[model samples]
Target: MQQDTIEQRPDAAADWPDQIYDLLKLHNIRQVALVPDAGHSRLIKRCIADNTMKVVTLTTEEEGVAMMAGAWLGGDRSVLLMQSSGVGNCINMLTLSSIHRTPMPMIVTMRGDFGEFNPAQIAMGNATQAVLEAMGTLVKRADTPEDVAPTVDATLRMAFNTFRPTATLLGQRLLGAKTFGKD
Candidate 1:
């Protein structure tokens, strides 16, 4: 299959999520397991509106891990959407995906990296990539809006086609820095 590629630009970031949704459909990803997060709110909404995909809201990040593993075992392709903080919650459970060589692809919205408002989000946010790598999951970063679609496209191909656990970290800059309080 020929892979579609897009040019990255500052203004193009806003369109990346939509591009990601299109790629999801193109890849035939039927199940989506996610812990609701503002970072992924738009993509989540897109998935819910599409009847073709089964979108599962998870109680915890680890639950999404297990859900994707089960989906893969049952012969369905799935993806997990979560924030950087949730990555910590999935560390031990990630072993399940890694050990079985499950094709677990994740879209992780980064926090505590750039323009972070909450101090508590710092630790896990910073450790997200390293932790996933330690568990044998391939990690990719989309720091620019242009990088989003291509990164997701390639990661999806790598995860499902290559049968490798993978994650794409969407930088806070691309998602917009979270504001703590209303003015």
Candidate 2:
């Protein structure tokens, strides 16, 4: 049933950026911190150019972790965008959300699975799910656009309402390999 819905929409596999923006808008999320990666390049570009969202590019993924903490302190809802490799860098700080009781949503572009040509991505991608769960985050994988909007909305709500982190895994099938548009 779910497979049929995903197969019917080609955009479901590639329209994560727009769908994510729609979810954020629906949730009233306005600020974001990100560590750039090929998977999220289109989304990041759209965020940078979009007047509606305040996008901050960080030096490291952990910086994004800290930045979100700060954003929450300032009363702005936000999410961190990064790749699976970045997850390793952000692991230790995962407890920050637990300690602070803040649901800091993270929208992760995952690799290390099917259609992944990059050898470097495989390990991190495989460990991504376990790592997120181990750190006490509720993880949801959005392999298609049809799944993205609802999953993101739910993740955000979980993070905020439950006061725990929620991670949405945007799989490679959704983002593709080639970085689209600008350099």
Segments in model 2 whose C-alpha atoms lie over 4 Å from true places: 1-14, 177-183
Residue 30 of model 1 has an lDDT of 96
- TM for candidate 1 is 0.88
Q: Write the per-residue lDDT of candidate 1 for residues 46-134, one digit (tens) a residue.
A: 99999989999988999999998899999899999988889999999988876888899999988776656667878998899999999
| TM-scores for candidates 1 onward, in order | 0.88, 0.85
Worst 10 residues of 1 by lDDT: 1-10
What does the lDDT come to for candidate 1? Answer: 0.82
Can you write out model 2's per-residue Cα lDDT over 84-147, one digit (the tens) per residue? 8898889988878978987689988776755655677678888998998999989999876678
Error of 2 at 92 (Å): 0.6
What residue pairs are clashing in model 2? 12-145
| RMSD score of candidate 1 (Å) | 7.5
